[model samples]
Structures are given as C-alpha cells and as structure tokens.
Target: MAEITTHQLVKEFPGGVRAVDGLDLTIADGEFFALLGPSGCGKTTLLRTIAGLEAATKGRLTIGDRDVTELPPGKRDVAMVFQDYALFPHMSVADNISYPLKIQRVPKSSRHATAAETADGLALHGLIDRRPGQLSGGQQQRVALARAVASNPTVFLFDEPLSNLDARLRLEARTFLKRLQRDLGVTTVFVTHDQAEALALADRIAIMKEGRIQQIGSPREVFARPANTFVASFVGSTPMNLHTATVSGEHVKVAGSSVPIPPSARSRVSDGDEVIWGARPEYLRWSTEPVEDSIEGSATIVENLGAAALVTVDAGGTLIQLVVDEDDEPEMGARGWVVPRIDRTLLFDGASGELILDDTPTSP
Candidate 1:
C-alpha cells in the first residue's frame, strides 16, 4: 500500500469549466479516505484523476515516492471499482476475477489458484461458475470486489460501489466493505454523495463543494463542531436550525427571548451585532412549562420515528425542531416552549457564514 498526495491539483474541462480546482491533499498510507459531496461537486472527477482515467490540468500527484501525474491508468498501480459493477457478462465469475492476472501474463494454473483464494476470502467460491447475469445484486458486487482484490494493486478506488443495492443490502455491504479494507490494509479512496455511508466507512472524510474542499475531519468532529453554516446544514441526519439574532451584551435575542451565549463564544461579537444562531434538533428540548432561555410556540408537526419522535414548533414566524421521547408525544397545535442547550449552541457571522471563534484570555 502507498500514500497518495496531490499538490495544487486541477482539472478543467473545455469552455473553462473547472471540475477540480487547486486542491492540496494528502491521504496516508493504508488509510480509508472518503470524498463526500452533493452531485456535480467534482468528487467523481477527482477520483478519476487519481486513478489516471482523467489527466490533471495542472499540478503534481505522487503515489508512494513516484510522480504519476502524467501516467496512463494502466501504469498507476491502482484498481478501480465502478458504480455499475463493470464485469464481463459472458465470463464466469472466476474468469472475471482472474482477468487482471491474465493481462499480467500469469500462468493459467497460478491464476486459477489466486482466483480461488480471493473468492474464498470474499465468500464467492460457491458462485465462481456463475455469470454476472445469473447472480444477485449483492453477489455481483462481491464479485466486483473480489476482482479488485485479485489484482492486489497498491491502491483501491471505489466510485459508489454500493449505490445500486437496496437499503438493507447497502447496510450489509457497508459492513462487509469496512471489514475487507481492514483485513487487506490497502490504501483506499471512496467517492460518494451519501453522507451516512461516508461517515460509516471512512476513517477521515473530505467534504467538497464546487470543486473545493470545505472541510476534512473525522465524522464526529465534523458532525459535532461544523466549520461553517454549509457543513452544519449538510453533515447531519437532521439539518441544524439557523436563525438570525442580534447579540445583546452576553446574550443573543431569538424570537423575542434572550438566550445567553456560551462562554466559549462570548467575545466573538459586540452588542447589537447581527449573528446567526445554530442548534441541532437533538440538542433542543420541548416542554409545556416555561424554561430558562426558552421560546414559546405552537406545535406544527409531530413525527413518530420508532424509538424517538421529532417535534416541530412554530415560534411566531420561525420554525424549530426538537427530539422527544416516544412515550411523551406532544399533540399537534399544543402550545409549548423550546429550550436550547446553551453549551451546544453555535454562532456564525450573519454575512460570511464563517464560524466565530472566541479570543484567548490574556494572562494577568
């Protein structure tokens, strides 16, 4: 396995459309990194460039210690798994997995042995004689993975390899993929638009937008402390609620209620300055009785989600969402108050969408 590094990497299509723009990143050796973003965010383009399927417009790329910026796909020492499971329809499972060995001119007997070993590792030995058309979607995906493993390349590139599976199958495939990567310890890069999938499978994730990386961190870091409003709204299962509020001394006025700012964010804004207040749904609580730093509202919607329920409260003009216990369900149209956990609140600049950091205390 080898580490991948890119410096000022760029990929510009015709008509001056830049898919990947001036990205500088280093993925460590044997690391399972994921590139996550919405559609048309240059994630796929970046992956293709790394695999040598697309040439870089400008910059340097290194795999291990070699500069591979201008090398063709075949010379990159990389194996790619496509979203559609690009297997030969007529070839048997064994033949498909052994195709890469054949191209390298391995003896037929050795190729068979390697194919059998890889198949057994992936639990595909029993289906080796079946063609792609005769296998289930999950089985086909396993075959594709086995084929990638058979090559034993220095790097593995997956472009949404599990997108076609059903929900339950997707979960199973995710666990399987994670285990496979751990066992092989190969440097891998996965590209996907699914945030949950990235969070579940990657050791580190780079969130991208408009060809530029927005943030790179562990899943917990990005989820708990988002770098900005974009990340706050994008990374969570339920988007964080944001509202414009005016800083009043040590407090911010929200929906006519004065809420104290966390001590960590006290020095970031001056009195009367407009700031954006952000709180996650799970961090807010709903109650019928008045609570400290709470806003009164009428319940607009209540959704039961198995073990928990999501409550939406319309406070005058703004809508706030909070999670409640399933046993204590709130009735729609009931008047209630929503209280935010001040320690978990986030503040952002109203115009820039940048997070406001507290200044360090001066030593006396």
Candidate 2:
C-alpha cells in the first residue's frame, strides 16, 4: 500500500484550456478517496496525470516515498479500472483477469494460481470459462476490477466504474467494490460525477469545480457543513434552499420574518453582515401548526416516493422542499408551514458564498 501525493498539479490542453489547475492532495496509505465533480471539471485529467497516461504540465507526484512525476505508466505502481470494463470478447474470464500478469511475463503456474485466487475472491470462480460477451454487466465489471487488482498495484485508480450499470446494479457493484477495497487495504482514488455515489463510498471526498478543488472532507463534513454555496447546492439532492437575509444581533431576518440564529453561527456573523440562509430538504418539516423554526407557505407540488415524500412548498417567492414521511404528504394548494431543523441549516456569507463557519462542525 502507498500514500499518493500531488503538489501544484496542473494539466493544460491544446486550446490553452486548463483541465486541472494547481491541485494539491495527499491520500493516506490504504485510504479510499474520491475526486467528485461535474463533467468538464478536470477530475479525469487529474486521474490520467496521476496514472502517467497524461503528463502534468506543472506538478510533482509521489507514491509512498518515491517521486513518479517523470515515470511512465508501466513504471508506476498503480492499476486503473475504467467504466467500459475493457475486456477482450474472445478471452475467457480467467484469461482476461490474468492478462496483466501475462504482459509482465509472470511464470505460467504463478499467473494461473493468482488468477484463480482473484477470481474466487471476486466471486467470479463459476464464470471463469465464460467469454466477456456471455457475462452480465455486473459480472463483466467484476472481471475488470479483478484484473486490475491481480497486478497488486500499490494504488487503485477508478474512473467511474459504475457509471454504465443500471441503478440497482450500481448499488450492488458499489457494495462489492467497497468490500473488496476494504479487504485488500489498497490506497484508492475514485473519480465520479455522481454525488450520491461519492457520498456513500468515499472515506473522504474532494469536490472539484472549474479545475480546482472547492472542498475536501468526509461525506458527513461536506454534507453537513459545505465550504461554499457551490458545494451546498451540488452535494445533495433537492439542493439547499438559499435566501438573502440580514443579520441583527443573534437574529437573521429572511423574507421579513425573524429567525433566531443558532449559537454555532454567533461568532461568524456580524450585526450588519448580509447572510444567506440555507436549509436542506430533509431538515424542513411540513405541518399545519405554527412552530418555532417554522415558515408559512402553500404546497405547490408533492412527489410521494414509496419510503418518503418530497414536497415543494412555495414560501412567498422561494421554493422550499421538505422530505417527509410518505403518508404525511400535504395536498397541492394547501396552506402549510415548514419548520427547519435549526441545527441542520447552513449559513453563508451573501457576497462570497462561503460558509459562515466552514471549519466548525454542525449538528446533523
């Protein structure tokens, strides 16, 4: 296992468009870290640079204690799993998994033994003789992952390995991948655009935007206390509802209504500072009674998902969403009120969009 580090990493393309810019990261040995962002955000480029598939225009990369910034892909102790599975259709599962060892010219006996062990570990033993075209998508993906690990590389780089699978298959694949990584204890760097996948699998996530990392933290940290508006809006489903507010003493006035600011945000807000109030969907409770932390509104839309319901309430001009018990969904055009779990709400500086107390933890 190895710790991977990158300092001032940068990648520029032919049109002078910078794909990755001034990135600095350190992945502890045996840690599962993820680079998450939208498309065209440079995560893929950074991964390619680390893998030695794409040279960095400016930066230094080190695996464990060795500097590999100038090394070729073959020389780096890293393995990559791509989205396409990339298996040869003509090759059997055993042949596919053993391909890397074959390329390095391992002794035939040792290669076969290692391949069998990996296949068993990945639950691919029964399908070893099947060709890539004959296996299911999940099985094919497992073959790709198994092959990548058969090399025993120090670092495992995953480039959206579950992107092609169906929703249910993705979940299953995620569990398998996480279990495999946990058992192997290999340092891993996963790249994905799916916020849910990143939150569910990564030990720590680096949220990227426009070629730069906006925030890096545990899934809980980024979800409960986002670094900025961009992260707040992007990290969760039904993005944080943002509203302009003015701070006065320990109170913030939003939409002409006064809401007491929690003590956690006290030191971060000045008396006259303009602030933005944000509440996540899960924190907002819909009810007919007036309550502390409650705001009045009219129900505009309701989506009753089997387990829970996502209700949208039009609070004056702002659309506030509440994820409530499925049976409690209010009818459209009904007058209602929303009570936000104060401890779960977020506050940001209006002008900068940065969290008021980014370094501090908030109650979940």
Candidate 3:
C-alpha cells in the first residue's frame, strides 16, 4: 500500500469550470480516507483525477515515492472500483477477477490461480462460474473488488461502490469493505455524497464544497467540532440548529430569549457582537416545564427516526429541533422548553460564518 499526495491539484474544463480547484492533500500509507460532499462538488472528479482517468490541469501528484502526475492509468499502479461495478457481461466471475492479471500478461495458469485465490478471499465461492448477468448485485460488486485486488496495486480508489446495493446489502457491504481494507491495509480513498457512509467508513474525511475542501478531520472531530457554519450544517445526520443573534452578557439573544454562550466560547464574543449560535438536536434537552436558559416554544413537527423522534419547535419565528426518545416525544402543538447543553454549543462569526472559538467545547 502507498500514500497518495497532491499539491495544488487543479482540473479545469472548457469555459473555465474548475472541477477540482487547487486541492492539496495527503493520504497516509494504508489510511482509509474519504472525500465527501454533495453531487457536483467535485469528489468524483477528484477521485478520477487521482486514478489518472481525468488528467489534472496542473499540479503534482505522487503515489508513494513515485511522481505519477504524468503517468497513464495503467502505469499509475492504482486499482479503482466504479459506482456501477463495471464488470464484463460475457466474462464469468473468475475471468473478471483475473482480467487485470491477463492485462499484465501473467501466464494463464498463474492468473487463474490468483483469480481463484482472490475470489475465495472475497467469499465469492460457487459463484465463480457465473457470468456478470447471472450474479447478484453484491456478488458483482465483490467481483469488481476481487478484480481490483487481483492487480495488487499500490492504492485503492472507490467511487460510491455501494450505491447500487439495497440498504441492507449496502450496510453489509460497508462492514465487509472496512474489514477487507483493514486486512489488506491498502491505502484507500473513497468518494461519496453520503455523509453517513463517510462517517462510518473513513478514518478521516475531507468535506468539500464548490471543489474546495471546507474541513479535513476524523469523523468525530468533524461531527463534534465543525470548523465553520457550513461544516456544522453539512456533516451531521441531524442538521445543527443555527440562529442569528446578537451577543449579550455571556449569552446570545435569539428567538425572544437569551441563550447562554457555550461556556468555553463566552470570552470569544463581546457585548453587541453578532454571532451565529448553534446546537445539535441530540445535544439539546427538551422539557415541558421551564428550565434555565430555555427557549419557550411549541412543537410544530415531529419526525420519526426509528427509536427516536425529531421534534421541531417554533420558538417565536425560529425553529429549533430536538431529538427526543420515542417515548418522550412531545405531541404536536405541545409547549416545550429547549435548552442547549452549555458545553456542546458552537459560536460562529455572524458575518463570515467562520467558527470563532479556538477551543471547541465537549460534553463531560
């Protein structure tokens, strides 16, 4: 496995649309990294660029110690799995797995042995004789992965490889993929628009917007201490509640109430400063009775989330959401008080939307 590095990498198309806008990145040897963002955010383009499928407009790219910026895909020593599992319809599973070895001109006997071995390692037993059209989606995906593994490349690149599977299979494949990567210790870079997948699979993630990375950190760091308003809003499964308010003495006035400044961030703002006060629904306390620093509100919407429910409260005109246990869910039109955990809130500059506190507070 090899580390991948890019310095000021840029990919521009006609009419000056820069799909990968001067990205600078490094993936440690054997690290599982993910490029996460919404569609058209250039994550797939970036992955393709790294694969040498889409040429970088400018900048240097290196795989391990080799300068692969100008190399062709075949010469880059990288294996890539596409979203559709791109297997040959006419080829049986064994042939599909051995295709890369065939391309490398390995002897027929050796290639088939390697293919059989790789297939077994991937749990593709009994299905080896079946053609792509005969195999299930998960099987085909494994075949694609087996083909990639047969190459024994320096790095692995995945382009939403699980997107085609059903939810259950996707979950199973996700677990399998993580284990496979751990067992192989291949330096892997995955691109996905699904934040949940990225959080679950990546050792570290780079959240991008408009082709530029907004933040790069471990899943927990990105989720708990987002670098700015955009990150706080983008990374969470439940969007953080963000409210525009003016700084008061150790508090922010919003929704006709004074919400305490997250304890560690209180000194970051002064009286009369404008800021965006934010809190995650899961970190909020909901009560029917009055609570200190509570925002008085009435439940306007309750969204079922399996064992929990998301209750959207209309406080004055601002809506704040809280994740309540299903049994504790307040009925629609019920008045409630929303209290943010004092140490779990965030403060961002109102004008720039940049996080203002250097020390992001954490729950005790």
Best by TM-score: 3
Off by over 4 Å in 1: 359-364
- Clash pairs detected, candidate 3: none
* Cα error of candidate 1 at position 71, Å: 0.6
How accurate locally, in lDDT, is each candidate? 0.90, 0.88, 0.91
- C-alpha lDDT of candidate 1 relative to the true structure: 0.90
What would the per-residue lDDT of candidate 3 be over residues 66-136, giving only the tens digit for each residue? 99999999999999999998999988888899999999999989999999999999999888888999988
For each candidate, what TM-score against the reference?
0.96, 0.96, 0.97
Q: After superposition, how far is residue 255 of candidate 1 from its true place, in Å?
A: 2.8
What candidate 3 gets wrong by more than 4 Å, as runs, is 359-364
- Candidate 2 C-alpha lDDT tens digits along 166-257: 99999999999899899999999999999999999999999999899999999998998889999999999677888888898878877656
Q: Judging by lDDT, tell me the better candidate of 2 and 3.
A: 3
Deviating ranges (above 4 Å) for candidate 2:
358-364
Tens digit of per-residue lDDT, candidate 1, span 1-364: 4999999999999999999999999999999999999999999999999999999999999999989999999898999999999999999999999999999999999998999899999988688888999999999999999999999899999999889999999999999999999999999999999989989999999999999999898887777667788888888777898889999988999877778886657877899889898989988888889887888898899988788898988988898888888876789999988888887888888998877766662211
